[model samples]
Target: MAVSFHSRSNSYPSRQHPQAAHVDEQLTRLRSFEAASSSSICQRFSNLQDLHDSLEKMISLSVTNQVLSQDQIEKLLDGSIKILDLCNIAKDSLSQTKESLKEIQSIVRRKRGDLSAEVKKYLASRKFLKKSFQKVLKSLKTGQNKNNNALAVFGEAETVTIALFETIFSFISGSKACGKWSVVSKMISQSTVTCEAEANEFTIVDLEFQSDKSLKVENVQILEACIQDLEDGIESLSKSLIKYRVSILNI
Candidate 1:
């Protein structure tokens, strides 16, 4: 048999070969690490995309809500403007009415003054006439014309009392006229007012209301007083006339 020589292939592998195998094992480990890193990168990208979608939805919702709120605010503002215009109209109307009332009050004062002057003049004339009649009756009572004086005094007294009645009636009619033209009717009609408003968290507003009823009551009291004075004057004059007639007849 030929001498069998131990071939290198049948012996242990060389250091170089083992080194190559170790390199291959390391490359395998590197490839596996690269694959895992790629998977992690893909997961991160998907998460980012989902976040971007959520942000876009939030932005769209915010814009839609903002637009709706703006529309509502515009409608509310329009209503407020209408209310303000109405208030302006009411103010103008009230001003006109006030001017009219002032003119009426001025006319009333002039009439009241004329009536007062008339009453004073009538009272003075009546007083003078009453003195003259009393003097005539006194002279006749001290003389032989007593019966004639009694007749004359009775006639004079009747006339004076009748005149007094007319004056009192005139005063009553004047008081009634005052009541008719008084501000009571105007005051009642202007007192009714209503207003409503809407506001957010940052504003406040005021509505106006007015009244003049106290003025009406004051005028009514003045008219009542005039009536009372007329009644008292009439009663006093009647009593005086009767007493004077009786005295002249007794003499």
Candidate 2:
């Protein structure tokens, strides 16, 4: 007897399959995870960048002038410790974000083999977004590492500047040098104001991302926008740090 084979329908059944429902649920969770993690990662980066800017300003001020008051030295030490603590916090947050991404990736991979064509398209888009997000996260990690290295250099520079300042303040304290130092001090003070204003802007941007409702994985354009914003911010931050480093070296 000859056996007959029927063609399979591409359409979903009137009743959903258990596996398909599970895949849908996983995708929904993945969307939520991605949005939350992106917001958290961006906010942490913003805070880290703000701390870096503040520390750079303090380091610049410490070195720009040949002399420093006892009060100024104390402030620099306090600020240095604060920046280190903030860096640690940002690092922890980054680690958490990575874990969250990994979990989502695992969930998707587990169900990917059984996915239907329509569902596969959704998964493929998600994978692309995930890879894009991973790039952003890697950029953030690189930036954080750079910040760590900068912190070390800044700390050493600060130590040398403090020792020199103490020596000059104790021995020379020339009236003309003091006058020049006063002008530098005012410039540093203005830089602090600028740092605060920039930080406020970053906070507003962070909040906007945190509250964003369109970051769903199904909405590819919005997801891409979020990634693009992160890339832009990272580029801006890199340029600013380079400029600050050059200025510090000149001083």
Candidate 3:
């Protein structure tokens, strides 16, 4: 009896190979990592966008009033600098996120399973975030320009008002007419009160901006009212100065 020895088949078909199972496990872990990274990127973008909005509101508040106290002005400048720092951090994170996504996409493409849809979604979202950030940056630049203009205007107005006050004071001091001098003194006192009140109003506006809930419609209205009050006070002071000048010339 001739017995043929049985030979094992070249392929094992009863169970999955160890190498295939290991590859599948690795692929699963990579997919989970990809998903987690994508979520993180989305969250970071959202946080950055919120910060951008806050910065814009702060800028608006800073530029609304021209006559901020030195302390208040310093606070605003510090706040703006902080915002810029935060923006830079966000930008760096965004860049890192994009690089991570690119590396993941390349890995997914080489893997057995297709992840084109997920990768495409992340790429599109990144594009949208880039555009949004650009727009916010443009707005920030515009706000800075406005602040500079407001500062210039404030300086000019302050110089003129100070000079006018000095001229009126000197004229009143040199005058001999008691009645005219009395009227001028009263006008000067009223103008000083008006100017102080305007400054107080502006301070209140600044306090509102510094509050936790700074971006309210009510804050905007308050700022507008303060600006109006400031304008009226300046106008009244100018009128008082004009009256003092005319009185001095007549005397």
Alpha-carbon shift of residue 136 in model 1 (angstroms)? 30
TM-score each candidate.
0.23, 0.29, 0.25
Poorest 10 consecutive residues by lDDT, candidate 2: 168-177
RMSD of each: 53.8, 31.0, 37.3
Q: Write the per-residue lDDT of candidate 2 for residues 121-172, one digit (tens) a residue.
A: 4334433533544444343332221212223333433332222222222211
* List of clashing residue pairs for candidate 3: none
lDDT tens digits, residue span 115-189, model 3: 445444544554454455445444443333123432332222222222222222222122122212221143344
Report every candidate's CA lDDT.
0.30, 0.36, 0.34
Instruction: State how far residue 234 of model 2 sits from its true place (Å).
Output: 0.7
Winning candidate number (lDDT) = 2
Q: lDDT of model 3 at residue 207?
A: 28
Question: Which segments of model 3 are wrong by more than 4 Å?
Answer: 1-72, 75-82, 85-89, 92-96, 99-106, 145-251
Error of 2 at 98 (Å): 21
lDDT of 1 at 189: 34
Candidate order (TM-score)? 2, 3, 1
